[model samples]
Target: MITRFEELDWQSTPIGDLTLRRRTEPAVGQEIYEVKLGDEYLMSSLFTVAEEELADLGLAAVAGDGLSVLVGGLGLGYTAVAVLQDARVTSLTVIDRLGAVIGWHERNLLPVSAELVDDARTTLVEDDFFAVMRSAPVEGRGGYSAILLDVDHSPRHQLDPTHADLYDAAGLRALDRHLAAEGIFALWSDDPPDDDFMIELNAVFDDAVAHVVDFENAVTGGMSSNTVYVARSRGTGSASLDSTPAHADKDA
Candidate 1:
């Protein structure tokens, strides 16, 4: 596929270096601009079903209240912005390994994100998502109401191969400890994994299910899709294998 992104105004900020590219596809019939931090593709001005579905998944778990949430990635700050829109979300913490991505959101992407970077409910932590989640304190009472991760495409096709551990059994067991009672965990992947991942999730979480969302190429109107793994905490918040959708945390 020829990814033609025009070089717009570029800026090097705190989070990472950002380059703006506008894709004008005659076949798709519309011009789309996208932000890229370093080499990673963030999002475009046209489509965002993956990010939206993730937020929707988080909202489905618990009712509106003072809830705490942990977002694994901060690509263009779209998901973070969406999460802060809910009155129920009192504290929204985001962990991203790349400082430039967070900084790009703080500077350029915020306008595209509707100024969610300035929201007080948001906290930006520059660290590895897994490392931070495995160590950060819950600040007493009411642990994380949800853990939403948009780390990679899917367990089978990871954008960052090193993150494969998160899809493994051990990493998920560690993730289970951080969830509060009635908390939900949402993971975004590009493609569905094999049966091994499903088996592992079944062995770990109380509830887990695959939520597939369709996407169309803005240029060609071609169809594409992504999957979200939704898993809810089980048993007195200790993490036990419950029903498939309730506890499992792997893609379809």
Candidate 2:
């Protein structure tokens, strides 16, 4: 008999305890993977629609080929793998604070591990995404065509306090320096569109918009949605969605 739940790996890091587990979802009767930091549920294999859109929509806004991209988070390798799907992307750099997560992809512990590991364009960097951005421009590096971020749950709530500044005006201005003149920045959020964050983006980028991504939630047997904010265009508006998550007012 197969066990319903299994713990794959666990580790102690500077942030907190990290854990990767597999559980058989009774509703689907299939293996589902999950990652958690301490007691906080980070990500699960059940819903990845929005994670994928972060790459699709972000890269879609880029006007040309030979795109240099940067992905801020590498959880489950979904976002990175999604980025590789675009043939126009020439380079991809993924920064994650946790080495354990990178190891998961390198060791083929996750479902999308093979895709990320085999891709030559993918560079998985173990570092603080925020700290790297602070000096990325001053380091004499070429700007990325698109910077896709999915690290935090939302602008209002951060996994760590250090990320809060990145959503502000000065922080955004610093990040703007790392972008090409036409480069775009896309962010994934677990909450609805934040007006204040939009203001911050518009302050630095030419244009910005928040897109609501709706997908089926098998766990809740209902629809769930996530917000993807894309900047560096020529307009501003929130792509509204009529649906909402089944849980609390905070979608995250």
Candidate 3:
């Protein structure tokens, strides 16, 4: 038996106050973990199918070994852990804007923290994800094979209003420079697929797709879904808006 509710940790971040808590569900009789930012809930352990799927569907689209991955958010560490499941992934760098959130995992406060911190390939970078995205490649590594993002809620609904620009055409094009030619970019969204966002992606990348992942909602006792958008970068030096599909083999 567990306590009905407990607040494990709390911190004030640039965006808002973040709180990590554990609670017992009366109906299910199970303990659930939750992360809250201000008045909004960032994540809940009860529904992580979408988060896991964001990594699965994104990596599935990549076609090579020794793949290097960059995860934009470290929420609950589900996506980062999922990225490590593949033997092909030789390196993974997780970037988060809030150092406090990263500290939670580093302090072993979260369930998946131990595994993530112990993984030899995992690197936790305490920095602004978007700022890094716009900057030059780190240590002149050229670019990453896959960039998995779950920082914001969705393309349309962002926790921070400034993040909305990242979903735009110009912002995406700038982000593409950080990807290896044929590198894949995948994003997790709390909302359903937005056709307008797909159009913006298509305008920037060689190929793009939106995957709808379904899962059972424990609270509502019904089905719920989230969207994952995956897109392949147009190789460096290639025309930005070329209609021809960029072949990964040719680029490699």
TM-score of each: 0.78, 0.90, 0.91
After aligning candidate 2 to the native by TM-score, how far in Å is the CA of 188 from where it should be? 0.2
- After TM-score superposition, what is the CA distance of residue 152 in candidate 2 from its true location, in Å? 0.7
Q: Cα-based RMSD of the predictions, in order? A: 6.9, 8.9, 6.4
> 209-237 in candidate 3: lDDT tens per residue?
98999998878889999999999997752
In model 2, the Cα lDDT at residue 126 comes to 83
Strongest candidate by TM-score: 3
Model 1's number of clashes is 20
lDDT of 1 by residue, 1-252 (tens): 465666855777544577877776566656676777678776665667878788878677765588898888887666787788788888988888766567766666444444666678888877777654444334462268888998676777665666777777766766776788768888877775456777777676767788777888655668777787888777343443332232222111
What overall lDDT goes with each candidate model? 0.70, 0.84, 0.85
> 173-237, model 2: which lDDT tens digit per residue?
66666677778999999999999999988887776999999999887899899999999932221
